[model samples]
Target: MKPGADRIELRGLKVRGYHGVFDFERRTGQDFVIDAVLELDLRPAAASDDVNDTVHYGELAERLAAVVSGEPVNLIETLAARLAEVCLADARVAAATVTVHKPQAPIPLEFADVAVVVRRTREESA
Candidate 1:
């Protein structure tokens, strides 16, 4: 984010997604945690005190959830990138950072979590 840029952040968004390379993983599914940070200028909303002037987080949550729960992708990187795209869809947003966490991964050893983070800008996607 740029200096003084405003942000809207969503954390620990859990969804059961059928995304994995293994057959058992795709069949049973696993919990995916998503964090999305959107950077934008909140000055207009602050001055006007209007919801329209800012991003609606409730709507954004639904959209993000849909992406996580809908189609199945093999890699969390792809998931993160897709989520960043959704975040950058708003014209007001300048940058978005998305992290996809797979807590229950099919790893042989004990681990806290596996995740992929992606950052995207409006200009980059364009």
Candidate 2:
């Protein structure tokens, strides 16, 4: 978003999914955390005071969870991309920033988390 553009932020959305490379990781689903920042113009919603004028965040969350719990991808990057697609499907959204976190990643050493961030903006067709 630009310096003054309106935005909607969704954070710490956790879902269970089977998205990983290892066989064990796929067989046993793991917890995945997602964060999203949706950039858009909220003036319409603000003035109209109508839910339809703005993106419904509850529905958005459900759609994002469906993507995470749907197909199995080997990379969180791919998962993040799919999530961004869902976010950008709304024509009103100017940009979508998606972050996928994997806390229980199979690493030999102690690590806090592994995550992938993806940002996508609407493409204006001429």
Candidate 3:
């Protein structure tokens, strides 16, 4: 299997975090929704039917949640970048795309959500 030919996706990972440009946002905190797509070759796992041959998405989810809950950042862009880094931490993941959604952003008008998306590869991450 070639790299980037297969994908494992985790969507709608919601965690409360203190990340925003405003002081009140940081103090009060809000729900941050995360979505991640990890690109890699999954043939080995498919053939062997072993968890070790592929990324364990459940474990990855937990790790991502930890990141969202851990540090306080100023921008969803930074948060997205951090999540991409976490996704790429697994050597088997050739690339990762991370999206961070802020539903309660301090916008004056009505909006569904504000978000940032970032894509990173192992080489770029290095």
Candidate 4:
């Protein structure tokens, strides 16, 4: 693949999660928005028009949701790293970028949102 061209993006994925250092934040929970872009060879899927030719996005999202909501973490960095790891677990995915958004943060000032984003590439072997 080229340096920066092809990608498969999953955007605005909403999930309820408990991730914070504060007890109230963990107990009450909040909505988290996730965006993921996967880089891979799309030629095979493009030619075949078969689900098997590419990574199953629906399944990936489901698993990601599970990971996002399953446990409580202190930082969005941790969440982003774990999600990236999960996405790269699929053999077909060569690289991925994950973003986790926190819209309703516990800050004093007003802002649109807070988030963590990460990009990762597959290991050399397999």
Q: Is candidate 2 or candidate 4 better by lDDT?
A: 2
> For this target, which candidate reaches the highest lDDT against the unseen true structure?
3
Per-residue alpha-carbon lDDT of model 1 for 1-126, expressed as tens digits? Answer: 372279999999999999988999889998999999998999899999999999999999999999999999988888899999999899999999999999998899999889899989888999
The sequence of per-residue lDDT tens digits that candidate 4 reaches over residues 1-126 is: 662366778999999999988898899999999999988888888999998998888998998999889989989899999999888887778888999999977999989889999988887324
Candidate 3, 1-126: lDDT as tens digits: 566689999999999999999999899999999999999989999999999999999999999999999899998999999999999999989999999999989999999888899999998988
Lowest-sum lDDT 10-residue window in model 1: 1-10
In model 2, what are the clashing residue pairs, if there are any? none
- RMSD after CA superposition, every candidate: 1.4, 2.0, 1.0, 1.8
- The lDDT per prediction is 0.91, 0.91, 0.94, 0.88
Ten contiguous residues with the weakest lDDT in model 2: 117-126
Q: Which stretches of candidate 4 lie above 4 Å from their native place?
A: 124-126
Pairs clashing within candidate 3 = none
Give the worst 10-residue stretch by lDDT in candidate 3.
1-10
Q: How close is candidate 1 to the true structure, as a TM-score?
A: 0.95
* Model 3, runs deviating above 4 Å: none
| Model 2 lDDT per residue over 1-126, tens place | 362289999999999999999999899999999999999999899999999999999999999999999999999999999999999899889889999999999899999889999988887310
Better of 1 and 3 by TM-score: 3
Best by the TM-score measure: 3
